[model samples]
Each structure stands twice: as structure tokens, then as C-alpha cells.
Target: MTDDYILVLYYSRHGATAEMARHIARGVEMHGVEARLRTVPAVSADCEALSDSIPAQGAPYASLDDLKNCAGLALGSPTRFGNMAAPLKYFLDGTSNLWLTGSLVGKPAGVFTSTASLHGGQESTLLSMLLPLLHHGMLVAGLPYSESALVETHGGGTPYGASHHAGADGKRALDEHEITLCRALGQRLATIALKLGNDRGPNR
Candidate 1:
């Protein structure tokens, strides 16, 4: 009974990751679960720099309550030198409070990422996002070989998570395979989340 929703939280620098999030949300809704899309503000070099309470465009900034109450999670980020982007990491780092309270324990979670180059650490970036979720005691769900797009995709798709290659110019749109995988990931996570039912834990 925790809200019947999966929180799709992410940070996109060049829009590729945001597009992936949209596809994933569609998949989540396909499974009859609400997909709550939220994003983090960009990190700034100036310590005092601040963004408007409402962003100029795109999803609203995520609050701790968003992650805490979700039935599931789909975390996405752009690759930052084989890791998750700083903005997403910064947001996750603040969730220690939730971790201590077991807020996310027993929830289903998955990761996705977009990269500017082929072989630019899509898998590594996805794995990097997974670490924090693991620490939160959430159940990690990943795409399997059963997803044909994973094998057929020359651009971006993986067993770990959905991904996209934005090319060196950061403008390549997600191909059909990548979009399929993204939707598949969302659908898979939503399916698991519905079956999970509010973190009440096993019937015991």
C-alpha cells in the first residue's frame, strides 16, 4: 500500500538520459503502476550557487519523500568518466537518513544511463548507480538475455540496465532497440514493484 508508484529519478546533462527516463516511465505505466519522474538540480562549482525552486523546464526536483515512499525505483544518469554524474550522486548521498530507517528496504530498483561515446562506460555507470541502491537494501532488478533488444542492440542495451549512445556530439537519438530496452526496464521494474506490495516484507 505504499503509493502504487515507481519513482524514476535521474540527472540528464544533454537530454539523452531524460529521454530514456520518459521511455521507462511509459513501460512502468504499461504495467499499471504510476511512474513519478523527478530530477535533481545541477551541481555548481560555486558553493553558494542556487537554482530556482521551480526549474525552467523538465521534471520537478525530487524530495526525500519521493524516494522514501515509492513502491519501486528507476535511477538514471549520464556517464561521468565511467561513473554516475555528480548531481545524481549528490542527491543519493543525502539519502543516508532513509537508509538508516530501512525506508527503501525490500523495494525493487533498476538503473539506466546515457553516454556520449560508444563503449563510454554505460555498464559501469549503471553499476555505479546500483551501489547506493544496494546499500539501501533494495532488491536489484536487471534486464536478462530474454530481452531480445539487449542482444540485438548495437547502440546501447545491456543485461545490467538500459542505456543509450549519444555519440561524440551528444546528439544521437536513442535508436529503436534502446527505446525498447528502456521501456522493458520500466515494465520489468513495475511488474516487480506491484508484486512486492508496500515493503511489508515476507508474509512470515
Candidate 2:
């Protein structure tokens, strides 16, 4: 059987959220769990045209099977007016089949976001992203007070989830506290997933 993996799925327009996804994946792998990084294609106004099957660079496009099969999930997106980007939402909308199958029930899930301003809806975006996962019956995970980075962060660490302040020009890199929170979120999700897996066993 294939080893269990956490799905690190995201859609990034300006690359800030993609960078955060990388850090989250790094944290996931550090916890002795596999992290499968995947991205969604940009949506086009013209439905007649199709996107390339493979992305130009970075992680490959995510398949529904990927989400359904994951041991856990860490979703990320750049803020789009207090919500997830259209492409990410579009991809998620297709997962209704998985929802019907109850494929993600009881799995641990987390959300992350990157915003252009400190008040540009990072927490709101993260919360919005969690809605679908909650509907799928996944156990939503959040960063806890025990994570020192959450207490010390001046940039983007929050108890809600990992976040980054990309600044007005979207040029600011993730701060140290932001990075720490990203890792903490990943490790926490992986640890919860492992425990759930043990509890369920092969019969599940």
C-alpha cells in the first residue's frame, strides 16, 4: 500500500500563497509524514479554451483523487476580498463527489492564506477556506496558544491558521514567526492524522 500523505493544495496568483504552501509542506514532511504539493490552474472567462494538462512549473495540477485519498489536508490561497481565489474555489466545487462518498470524513484539515496588507483578510480567507472542509466532515485544525510564534508574531501568525503579510506590493517574504506558525500547523495536522489513522486501522 502507498504511504499516507497530507495534501498541500492551493491556488496562487502572485506566488505569495504558493510560497506559504511550500513552507507548510516542509513542516508536514518534517513530521515523518509525506506531503503532496499540488496546484490548480487559473480559471478562464472563456470556457471554450482549456488550460494545459500540466502546469508550466512548480507542483502538478491536483486531481480529485488526490484530495480524496489524502491522510490529511492543508489548503492555502491568496486573499481575494476576504475569500479564497476563484480557481481554488472552482477546484473545490468539483469535490462534491468526494463529499457524497464521505471520503474526507474525520480527516484533519487546515487552511492558510497570504495577503497584500496586514488587515487584508488573512484570517477571514482562512476561515472561508475551512467551510468546505467542514462540510466534508473533516476535523478542522487550528494553531494553538502553545505555539510561541503565535504569541510573538507581529506579521502574520494567528491561532486561526498560518498566514503571511505579502505587503502592498506582494513583495514581503514570510517573517520568522509566520514561518514557525506554518511549520507548527503542518506538524499538528500530521500528528492528528497519524493518530486518526492508528485509531481507524486497515479496516477503515
Candidate 3:
């Protein structure tokens, strides 16, 4: 079997969430595991919705194979009315096959999000994304008090996962605490995946 790798998957509309994904990937790599960054395409409102086969920029489109093969997962998105955006949700809804096959069972998973405002539902959105992973029987991970950034963050880091206050203009960058937490979440997940992977042996 292939070695361990953490899949950092996300859908970024204004880029903040994508940046957070990068930070999380950095954290994963710091723990000596490969970080695979992937993103989903946007959906159109037209009755016949479609997206390009390859994304114009940023990470390439993710496939079910990526999800099934990943050693761990870090899902990210922007908040939409206290829920994950539809594009991310749409991509996840297609993972039922992985769920049915139990391909993702026992893997470690985490969630992150960015919001236009401080009170714009960052935590709730992260929680919403975790539900599907839970149903897939993945081990859910969240930031803990050991991460000092959680207490210092005025912008977005939370126990649920890393988040960013993108502001109304969507131009504000992630603060130091947000960055620290993002990395912490990535490291935490990778560490867990490594331990679990070692226990499962080469057959897994």
C-alpha cells in the first residue's frame, strides 16, 4: 500500500479559505506526511449547471479516489448562512459511495471555514461539514486548549477548527492566531493519522 498522506480539500470563493488550506497543509507536512491539496469546482444556478473539467486556477478538482485513498482529511469552505457553501456540500453529497463501501472508515478528519464577518457562523459552518464525515465513520478531530492561539484569536480560530474573519470586503488576511491554529489542526491530524496508520500495518 502507498504511504500516508493528508488530503487538504476545500472550496474557496474569495480565496481566504484556500489560504487557510495551504497553512493546514504546511502543518501536515511538518509532521512528516505528504499533504495533497485539492479543490472542488463551483456550481452554476442555471437549470443545467456545469463547471469546467479542470479548475482555471488554484488546486485541481478532487475525485472520490482522492477521498477513498487519503490517510486523513481536512475539509474547508466559506460560510453561507451558518452552513457550508453549496459547492462544497454538493461535492460531499457525492461521497455516499465511499460511505457505503466504508473506504473512509476509521480515518481522521477535520473541518475549517472562513466567514465574511466575525459572527457570520464560522463555527457552525465547520460543525455542519463534520456531520457527513461522522456518518462515514471517520474519526473527527478538533483543536484543543493546548493550542495557545485558540485563546488569543480575536479574528477566527476556534475549537471546532481553523477559521478566518474575511471582513465585508473579503480582503482581510488571517491573523496570527488563525494561522497558528490552522497549522496546529493540520499537525494534530497528521500525527493521529501516522499513529493509526502504523497500527494498521501495510495491509491497511
Candidate 4:
């Protein structure tokens, strides 16, 4: 566990959200910070953690320490009918312990998402993901209009957060505009995290 990193946390079914997370991580590094990419395991019908101690591919399963000790966070997920996917939500629900101790207070955070259609609740999903960070007392930030990709995007990009409009079949590769915004979101979080670092000591 590291206290000097931004945690890039997300859940992806068709890989779009995971792809976005990678881009965000790149942006975080661009801002001269380490980015810890992490994911949650899928849950069973009763919401129990799936048997594996770690995921077979992509990022490893995120520990509570990942969330608790992060300097900042970038949460991403595939859209679940205008909300975050259940796996991501399930992981957040376990953070009540961190909330009680205010471990996440004053940390900067951002969100990103992928949707199956152009109107498939991208903004809503982004907003939905932010709710948990807000409750954790994180200082959540969204992309500012200063980023030109927000105005030129035909794919998925929102002032609310970074997003990708995966085609209905879920095969649409991220367009340049969507990629830009994802990196922008990551950069924003990293920048804010560094500025806030001096004012706040390590929560861990």
C-alpha cells in the first residue's frame, strides 16, 4: 500500500471501463504521481465476493487499504441502467469503516464510465459513481469546459466526468475525444491531489 498514489478503481464487464481506467492512470502519471490501478471481484447472487482472492486478469482486486490510503481516486464503471455496476457499488458499501474514521476526507476524486449506447446514461452513471466518494468526504472534481474535447466529442465526454459511448454491441473502441477526457479527468485528480498533499498528512 502506498500513500503517494492515486487509486484508479473501477469495474468493467466488456472492458470499456477498464480501458478508460488505463487512460486515466496514464494521465495521473503525466502529472508526476503514481497511479494504482485496482478492481473489485464480481459478486455472487447474494452479493458475496466471488471465490477468487484475486482477479485472473486486468487489475488485481482492490483492498480497503487501497481506498483508505490513496492520495486521490479515480472511480470508473460500466453503466448499469444509468448507475454504477453492482460490483463497484458492493465494494463501496464496504467502506463504512473508512467513513467512520474519516480516512478519505479531503482527498480528491473523479469518475469515469462506459455505456452501450450514445444515450445510455453516461452522465447519470458518472454522477451515480460520485455519490460514494462524496459520502466518504472526498473532494470530487469534474472536467472543466477548458478541455476542448468536451465540446468536440461525438462519442462520450461530459463535464460531469469522463465517459465512453461503447456501441450497442459493446465493441466500440474509445474515440480520441473520449480518451482525451479520460486522461483529463486523471490529470485533474492528480493535480489536485498534489496541491492538497501538503495541507493534509497521510491518512494511513
Model 2 ranges off by over 4 Å: 48-50, 201-204
In candidate 3, residue 183 scores what lDDT? 96
Residue 27 shift from truth in candidate 3, angstroms = 0.3
lDDT, candidate 1, equals: 0.90
Candidate 4 lDDT over 1-204, as tens digits, reads: 224999999998889899999999999999889999999888868758764897778899999998887889999999988999988998899999999999999999999999988999989898998888898888989999999999999999998899998998999999999999999999999899888866776563
Candidate 3, lDDT over the whole model: 0.90
- Which residue pairs overlap in candidate 4's backbone? none
Instruction: List CA RMSD, all candidates.
Output: 2.1, 1.8, 1.7, 1.7
lDDT of each: 0.90, 0.89, 0.90, 0.90
Task: State the local distance difference test value for candidate 4.
Answer: 0.90
Clashing pairs in 3: none
Per-candidate total of colliding backbone pairs: 0, 0, 0, 0
TM-score to true structure, per model: 0.95, 0.94, 0.95, 0.95
Off by over 4 Å in 1: 48-50, 198-204
lDDT at position 170, candidate 1 = 91
